[model samples]
Target: MHIVITGAGRGIGRTLADRYRAQGHSVTGTARDGSAEIILDVTKPDQQRAMASQLRDTAVDLLICNAGVYLDKSESIVGYPTEMWAQTFASNVTGVFLTVQALLPNLRKAKGKIAILSSQMASHTRAPGGSYIYRSSKAAVLNLGRNLSTDLRHDGIAVGIYHPGWVQTDMGGPAAEITVDQAVDGLMARFKDLSLENTGCFDTFDGQAHAY
Candidate 1:
């Protein structure tokens, strides 16, 4: 399988890339710092186009839209700034969309699956207060994934939105419930089971259906 992963510099994205490569799959991992196979800042259109050009005519079996930011964490309602919201949405929502848009042709060639790493926080039922910017961005991406699933089904492509669990990563913190490896193990299983019949489904890393 030829897999493309964004934000592979660290955390769950990095781990996912490593595991896939270890399994002898062809992995195209991207990071903003140029440390991976591709240097892609998902919010940048030029970079997105450059990536598409690099992988042109190649069959991308899987595209993982994992580049995201969780700014505005612990911010009070009045403390949230406008710029924070803009940056968050750009990375978490618009970035995901642009990546999918740029790679549409490659995905079509392989009838690939798209795995969008959303969060349980994205659910309306999970709203418990702060991190408004992060929560809203995630929710928006979930909506984007669902809509993309519907449109891409005709192309024989599947899209699944996921909550990768409270992972022990820079974003999830040390106190988080699951280790990066644990989260990756579960996520890989979910990704493996993704198909047209389950497209647009919101699910947890462990395979449970998540609330929209």
Candidate 2:
């Protein structure tokens, strides 16, 4: 299968890209700084267009919208700046939408699947307070994925939102619960099981259904 992953320079996305490649799947990993196979800043429309145009003749079997930011992780309720919220949403919410829109044609051509890397923090049930910008952006993308799933049903495209767990990556921190390898393995399984019948499902990397 031909897989396209955004923000694959590190963390879960990087691991997924490497694993897929090792499995003999064609993988195009994109990074914001041209550090990976493709140079795509998910927040940029022109870059997205360029990517779509470059891959015009290729069929994408899977498109993983994994590029995102947690800009407000350090913000407190008293000091949450407006710019932080806007920047976070641009990459985490709008970026996901733009990627889907830009690659819809490729997805339609191959009847592909889209795996959106949302977070359990997005769930109303999992609210533990703080990180307002990250939480809200993730919640927004979850909504976007669900609606996109319904809208693209007839096109044979499946969309799923997932939480990759509290992985021990740069973003996830040293004290996080899961390792990158564990998260990647579970996520790969989840992606393989994704289908039109299960589209728009929000679940953990380990396969448990998560409450929205």
The lDDT of each candidate is 0.95, 0.94
How much is the lDDT of residue 99 in candidate 2? 94
After the best TM-score superposition of candidate 1, give how far the Cα of residue 45 lies from its true spot, in angstroms.
Answer: 0.4
Task: Judge candidate 2 at residue 104 and give its lDDT.
Answer: 92
Compute the lDDT of residue 136 as modeled in candidate 2.
Answer: 93
Per residue, candidate 1 scores C-alpha lDDT tens digits across 24-132 of 9999999999988999999999999999999989999999999999988788877989999999999999999999999999999999999999999999988788888
113-207 per-residue lDDT for model 2 (tens digits): 99999999999888789998899999999999999999999999999999999999999999999999999999999999999999999999999
> Per-residue error at 203 for model 2, in Å?
0.7
Off by over 4 Å in 2: none
* Candidate 2's TM-score: 0.99
